[model samples]
Target: MPARDSIDRHIAYWRAEVPGLDPDVEGVVTRMQMLVRHLQRRRTEALGELGLLSWEYDILWQLRAAGPPYQVTPTALAIALDTHPATLTHRLDRLTRAGLVERARDRADRRSVVVVLTDQGHRAWESAIGSQADAEGLLLAPLSESERRTLVRLLRKVVLASEKDGTELMVVPRSVQRPEH
Candidate 1:
């Protein structure tokens, strides 16, 4: 038998409390939720160490990931961050004041503006991302490389199924999609 974990105990308790509770379903759901919470906590701690709030790291990361000469329109950025334009404007104002980013008028379209990531912003993003990657690596360290690959494949399959169904949101955030080289 596989080694039992906290989810196993949780399933047992729920099965007793609710006679029809399905251990298989409950185990999978609870374990996934717990794993996400654990990762979020680790990421939050890592961001804190880099003196960044989660939203700040997210905006910086989105800009950094936008390929060289990292810049994007405020509207595009707002969409990428799944935030309102006004909210993005507020955040960008703060970022600009901190010298992490700058607002520049588009050369092609003088009326439009773009948000450019400064050297400081890139450095902050790099530090926070490195720390978060280390935390994720440590979390998955117990799995063999092949096991990790298998897990990725399985999770991708499940996620795709969810996306295909109407039950889950189908949009993949632009920041998360791999950029073409």
Candidate 2:
């Protein structure tokens, strides 16, 4: 398992110490919260070494892996990244200047623009993939193969459930839907 610190040890302590709680939410929800913290911290650190923040890496990686026009509308991009228009606009502006991402006319909607990954961005992403794999392997090394499959199955159930609370996860649709236009 990846090195555990005092923070990991104390997470359960704090969970148990919550002053008042709903039984159902307190279990799975709190565990998810703590797990997210652990995951994000390591992910940020691991991804940072490549000189790319998670959000920036995420945007570029999505565009590159899309494997076609290598372009997507800003709205569609925002949905993929779980970000807002203003936030996407700001990041795109930065990436555009860095020559990592480019803005091009959207053939589908003349009024809209699309983000496409540039050559440099694709090369950087290729270099970063190894680091990303290393980080993910370390993060998940604790579980056995069967346990990993079981955990993924259980998490998929929660992720696909309809949202009752308006939370950050609202950005992620219960399932990606493709409708004929």
Best model per lDDT: 1
Residue-level error in angstroms, candidate 1, position 46? 0.9
- Per-model C-alpha lDDT, please? 0.86, 0.76
Cα deviation in Å at residue 131, candidate 1?
Answer: 0.6
Model 1 segments more than 4 A misplaced = 165-181
Top-TM-score structure, candidate number: 1
- Per-residue lDDT, model 2, residue 106, is 83
Off by over 4 Å in 2: 1-29, 79-86, 107-112, 160-181
lDDT, candidate 1, 1-181, per-residue tens? 9999999998888788999998888888898899989999999998888778899887887787777678888888888789999998899999899888999998879999988999999999989888988988998999999999999998888888887756555554564467569
Q: What is the lDDT of residue 91 in candidate 2?
A: 95
Candidate 1 to truth, TM? 0.89
Residues 51-126 of candidate 2 have per-residue lDDT tens digits of: 8888888888778766666777788888888799899999999989889999988888888888888999888788
